[model samples]
Each structure stands twice: as C-alpha cells, then as structure tokens.
Target: MTDLNKLSLAEARDALRDGDVTSVELTEACLKAIDAADVLNAFVHKTPEIALERAKAADERIKAGDAPAMCGLPIGIKDLFCTKGVPSQAASKILDGFKPEYESTVSQQLADAGAVMLGKLNMDEFAMGSSNETSVYGNVVNPWRRGNDDAQLTPGGSSGGSASAVAADLCLAATGTDTGGSIRQPAAFTGITGIKPTYGRCSRWGIVAFASSLDQAGPMTKNVRDAAIMLEAMCGHDPKDSTSAELAVPNFEAMLTGDIKGKKIGIPKEYRMDGMPAEIEKLWADGAEMLRDAGAEIVDISLPHTKYALPAYYVIAPAEASSNLARYDGVRYGRRAQLAQGDGITEMYEKTRAEGFGHEVQRRVMVGTYVLSAGFYDAYYNRARKVRTLIKKDFEDVFAAGVDAILTPATPSAAFGLGEMTEADPVQMYLNDVFTVTVNLAGLPGISVPAGLDGQGLPLGLQLIGRPWEEGDLLNTAYALENAAGFVAKPGKWW
Candidate 1:
C-alpha cells in the first residue's frame, strides 16, 4: 500500500504492462488513499465509480494491445477544467451547479491520450487568491509540519488542491492552470515540481477563464520527468481555441537528459530584491553553484521592468476577469439566487451575482469593472497593458543578449501560515506572486523545481523562466535542478 502511494506514473504504467498490477488495483489504491486523507479536502468530487470503470476499460485496452501513452495512469483534474457531466466550479460559489456539456480541450486531450480522471481537485475561488484560504470549500492544508508546530500551513493557491493531491500521492500527477503563479507557486508550496508552459501552449478552450491572456495550463507532479511525461500529453494545437499555438508538440519525455554542459543559464539581477528571505537567497546562490559545477555557464542578466510587473499584472488580470465573468448574469449557466417578491429580471441578475460571488472575487470584479470603465480605462487598464509590453520587452532584450534561460525564486518566500496572509492587507497577499507573475505577463514559459528548505523546514522552489515556446529548455534546466536539490520527499509536516 505504501509502495502504491509512492508509485510514479511511469511506474504505474510499467506495473500495468508487466501484469505486476492491474489498472483497477492502481485506481482502487488511489481511491483508498483519497478516503484516508479526507482531512485535506484535496478532492472536491470523487467519482470512484467512473474512475473504476475507466480503469477497467484501460485494463481491457492493454489486454487488446490498444493502449495509448498514459494507458492506465490516474490524474487529478483541477475543478477549473470543465469535464463533461462533472461539476467544474473553479472553486467559486458563482459557478456552483455549473457542469459543462463539453470537456475542456486540455482535459479532453489528456483523456484522449488514455489518462484516467480521478476527480476534480479544489482551488482558490475563481483562481483569485495566492493561498488556498480564499477557497469557498475551505483551505487545503499542507501535509507537512514543523517539529513541534502543529498549525496548518497553506498549500499555495489557486491550484493548491492539485499540488496537495500530487504531493500526498492521492494521485500520480494532476492538472493545474497557471495565471500568475497558480501552478508553480502551489508546486513550490507542496514541495513538488510543476511547469507553466509558454502562454497559449495549452489550449484554454473550456478552462474557466480567470485572466485569459495570462492563463496557461500545465502539469504538477513529484518529479521533473513525470512533469515532462504529463506535459507532453497536455500540449497541442486545438482548433477550438483560436489562441492555441499551431506549433508541433515536442517529445518532452524523450528529451529529459541530465546534461547541462555549455548551456547558458542567466541569473537575473533584478529578481534579487531586498527583504528576500535569507534561505531563498541562499537556495538561488546554491542552484547557480550547482549549475556552475555541472559545467554550465551562469551569467548575470538584467530585466529592468521587474518592479512594475506585479502592479501591472494585478490591474490587467482583474480587468480581463471582469470582462470574462460578466457572462454569468443569472440568465445563462451557473447558479441563480431565487428572486425576491418585487425583483425583475435585472434585479434577479443583481441579486444572483451578489449572493454567488465571494468577497475577494467581488472585490476583483469591482476593481476590474472600475478600471475598464470609460473614465478610468486609460488611467488603469491601458497603462497596465503598456507596462505589460515593457515587461515582455525586458525578456526579449535579455534573451537577445545570449541568455538561454533566467533563474529566480518561484515565490518571494516559502508557504506562509494559512491565516497569516488573511490578517494582512490584500496587497501583501498579492506581493507573494511578485517573482512569478512577470513571466506570465511577458508570455514566457516558467517552471518551479524544489530547490531547498528554509530554516523553518518548509520547501523552497527555484524558478526557471524561458523564452516563449521554449518549454523544452526550461524543463531541461529544471531536470538538472531537481537532481541537484534531491528533495523529492513528500510533505513531511502534517497539519
């Protein structure tokens, strides 16, 4: 049973192929694990019947020699990814009772490649918060703990549940969408590896749009090789999504070499901000040293527009979210509050929205609407977009200067106490994404690998930001760092 929990997707597949284990056995093992770890609330919905049925089918396919790449592997789909006949809430009350008649392009693509869906995992309501605390379903606590400290710590959000589930071995790997650090941050918090591919690398067709322009779907798993395998299955061109890249997907799993010799890795000078936690700073330095020892050239590069990225992303993401969420006005899909005695159609729409959206989401919607309004449009929304261009330009300039990739900390600090953030102001919470958001704004590929642990023993993540559509290179570097860090242990501190 313990070995079942520790099995990688490759191991599980090999077991199935060798007849050492059956798909049903693997699926049942995961179901048992999910039931055992119920306190985590990692899964919002568990369709054991569906999962078993899928596993049985996979078993038959294997017998018939018709298996696909991920033949019998079970994966956790984030609730943000719409699943046909399965509730896809984005962890928001506003989207409650919303079940798409269609599957998200990415989810469908994975299913097409033969991966089994365990269930939908939890997330920050509408993918808004930095910590999972903002979830309407309640916080998903980290499965690790300090020596004597028993307080629950945050598994990073909006993809927190995906990270937690993968880390806890509730599922082999899980799908997570990144809009400003959603995937990588949670992966870091949970002491796992996750990647946010270049924007538009994965189709966002049926994904609940948080910040459409910034959103990119990726995989979260225990190791870089697993991430590479899952990511290969996840990426492709989709006619359903116009923004989906037409580029051919690479065989990422085949390219995971331990070699880094002669690779030009850049250390961005701007990311080394003041007040950075000492442990994180040390981890960055140590990571650079590891690459140097591996015979890779580490050069210092500058991204001058770094300071402006956080403010610009906050403005732009909210602005886009406001426009995207306006469709849920009580008439179409999603929940609708019962009308009061005197309420008309417009009043019904007003009442439904007020009752459905949570506090943080409401605040964001208001900010988004206010910024896009006639008078404030130029001052807030447009100006933020201009800054976004400058941030992208910074990356372009650095890349042109002969830097292959840039390295930085995935988050400003390690995962904070769940309630520690709620007590502070919203800007403080937003600042957590300071280092990760710039890559999203610049439309570049970024990934987080377990770097080291802080003095408190919480895991730290080192981020590698790559040029647009250069996920292969980013994953290669992350593979190197993953070996260097040697921190593949699961969440040891249980809340």
Candidate 2:
C-alpha cells in the first residue's frame, strides 16, 4: 500500500469509505510521520492518546453509516485554536501552560464532523513574525532546500508549522490563521495550497488574536481539492463569534468543474517589484499564460494604492495588536513572573510581559503603542487607516470593473535561509508580506497554489485574490489554476 501519510485528505476520505483503510491505521501512520519529522519542529505539542481516541470514535461513526466528509481523517490543529484541555499556546511564552477549558469554534466544528486531532502545530509567537523564527519552540525548517546546500530555510509564518506539516505529509491538512499574509505566504514558501477565506467567513472565537481586523482562519493542504474539502468542514456560522457570517456554507468541492471559460482574471501591474528575481517574474507570466490557455481572459489592471498597503497594514495591524494583546497580563490565565517582596502590580506587569514576549512581538507591541499614543496618533495610526481604506478601494475598483479574481506571485521569491535576512532592517522581513497583505486589508479571500520550482529546485507559488463572500467561486478558480499548473512536486524529506 502507498504511504498512508502521503495520501491527500480527499484520497484518505475515499479510502476510508471504501474500507481500504481505517482511521486508526491512518492515524498511526501520521503519528509515525510526526515522530520522524520532529526535527522540523512543525508540531510543538503532541497528543497521541487524544488522536487515537478520536480515531476510534471516527471509525465507529463510519461503521454506523454516520460519517461526514471529514470523518476518519487525521488533521493538525494550529496552536492558535484553543482545544479543550490541550495546551493552546500561540507559540509564545506569554501563553505558557495556558489551556482552554473549552474548544475553539473552528476546531469544534471540525471535531463535530468526526476529524481526528493529531496535535497543535507551531506558529509565530503571538502570530507576529513573517518567518517562524519568533516561535518559542524554535524556527520551523522548510523541508525544501536549494541545490542541497543544507542551509535551513523558513517555512514562512505565522502558519509555518501548518504549512510545513502538510507539505511534509505529517498530517493530511492543518488549520491556519492569516493576519497580514500568515497563511498564503507560508503556503507559498512551503509549496502547498492555503486559502484565507474572507475576514468574516471563519469565526475567530477561540483562535489567539493577532490583528483583530485582519485575522482569518483557513485550511492548508497538498492539493486544491483537499483544500476545498477541508475548508467546507472548517466554515460555518457560530453565535459565539460576532464576526461569523450568517450565510450557508456551500459544498466547495462540488464546484470544481475546471471550466473557467470567460472568467476575467486581473493581473496587477504593481506586483512586479523592482529587482525581483527574473524567475519570479517569469513564473508570474507563465501562470497567467496557463490560465489564459484555460480560457480565462488575462487583463492587466492597476491597484494604484498598492505601494501604501504595507505601510498601512504595519500600522493598523500593530495598533489592533497592541489593544488585543493587553489582556495577557499576569493577572489572568497563563504564565506569571515570580514576584519580589516589594513588587507592586506595575512591577508584576512589567516583569511578566518582558519575560513573556519575544523580541519581535515586543517590537510590534511597542510600535503599536507608539502609533496609538497621543502625540503620534494622527501622524501614524490615523494616516495608515486612511491609506488602508484607499487600498481596499483599489481592489474594490478592480472588482467593480468586472474582474472575477486577481492573480499575482504569492511571495517575492523562493524560500530564504533561516538567518539570510538580517535583523538590521526589519523592513526586509516585513517586505515578505508586500504581495499578500492587501488581501487581508481588503477583507477578501486569497489562495496560494504551488505553481513551479525556481532555478535552485525550491518551489514557487501563485496567488489569487477574490471578491469578499465568494470563497466557493474563488476556490473553483484555484481549482482551474491548480489543474493548469499541474504542480505535483513535493519537497524531498531530509528532516
């Protein structure tokens, strides 16, 4: 039999239904893979007992003819999702030893559909960094390498672990949250399919907060079809989350007809960053041509405010982050610093926070606090908000002009070595999100599909942004691009 861990989520689903495999067997295969891939640091928490229990229940459901699409499937839950009795740290020391008594809405939904939980995947500490370097568990190494250099490369972030786990076949699929390109960027870097649904599409009830307005949850999988199948199970209305959409969830997999004839795919002129690798430019053009051959009209369009998106996103996301993260003081759940005899509340607060947050997270929180300060509020935060509105308007204008979706390169380039980009300029790291932040700011759906490999044999991906509240259509479009690209390259396992 083929490696059970290598089967796509959809393939595993069918296999279970046909009695070719059992959830227990599939779960054991995944656990074995996880044990072997521990060097990657993809999973920060391991829960084999819980996984086996869930698998047994799933097998029972299947035997009773009560199975759903996700029944008998093993999946990795992002640490951001609060699973009852499971450590739900957001890969941060601030959340050390914190486990929610209740399950997150999204994970709860997947569990209700009979999905087996493998464990918690690592992520950016407080979901702040572009690379997984900010994670307290250590950086997650991308399985892909450049010409066998053996230099460690980041799997992008803050969904780095989810992307890494799926690409390495550690799990069939994993849940990921995107706040200013967390999901798509990592997916691109890891050579997998990841979709960030519209801002309100997935409830953020129990996932750790990043930038409130920009955070969204979606599925990361090996193929577009698997993404569609898992995504359908991940989304729905939840009264617990105020941002949850009231609309009915559609059967996204059934919408993949592969016929995108006459669909208008917009090509943003500004994504061609100066000095970008010629390979990236060529891949973008090649992706466009592939879609064009698939009968979609390719038209060049300008998102005039594209240049301001990063600046605005940096300001706005941090501002919200500062406010949202204020709740993590030592008074509540999670870790607390040891108090000295003379320590006051202020001292405890300072000591706990300083000890808890990592460097990158501290930097963002300070920047956020500064922007929201009285002296700089208008100069920084307010202006950035205005720019955000303009950026959203830019996409709205393009969509209003009859574009069904916009296509662009998912990342500026292939995966970079873990320490390649220096800390002398954090902007270098921030620039990684330049292509993907606009989608989050506009509250639109975006997907990254592995498209090709670079000259060094590392994978590259193409991104598609769709209008709000149209994920089924967006996913169908991704299906077309996925079929056109026929990208089946997997990162050779060296970890």
The candidate that wins on lDDT is 2
Mark the 10 consecutive residues where model 1 has the least summed lDDT.
Answer: 486-495
Which digits, one per residue and each the tens of the lDDT, describe model 2 over residues 1-495? 569999998999999999999999999999999999988999989999999999999999999999999998999999999999999999999889998999999999999999999999999898898889988899998989898788999999999999999999999999999998899999999899999999888999998998989999999999899989999999999898888889998999999998899999999999989998999999999999998999999999999999999999999999999999999999979989999999999999999999999999899999999999999999999999899889899998999999999999999989999988877889999999999999998999999999999999999999999999889888889999999888989988787
Backbone clashes in each candidate structure, one number apiece?
Answer: 5, 0
Estimate the TM-score of every prediction. 0.98, 0.99
Candidate 2: deviation at residue 138, Å? 0.8
- For candidate 1, lDDT tens digit of each residue in 280-363? 889999999988887789999888989999989989999999999999887888889898798898998888889888888988
Question: Which residues of candidate 2, in runs, are more than 4 Å off?
Answer: none
* Runs of candidate 1 exceeding 4 Å displacement: 493-495
Quote model 2's TM-score. 0.99
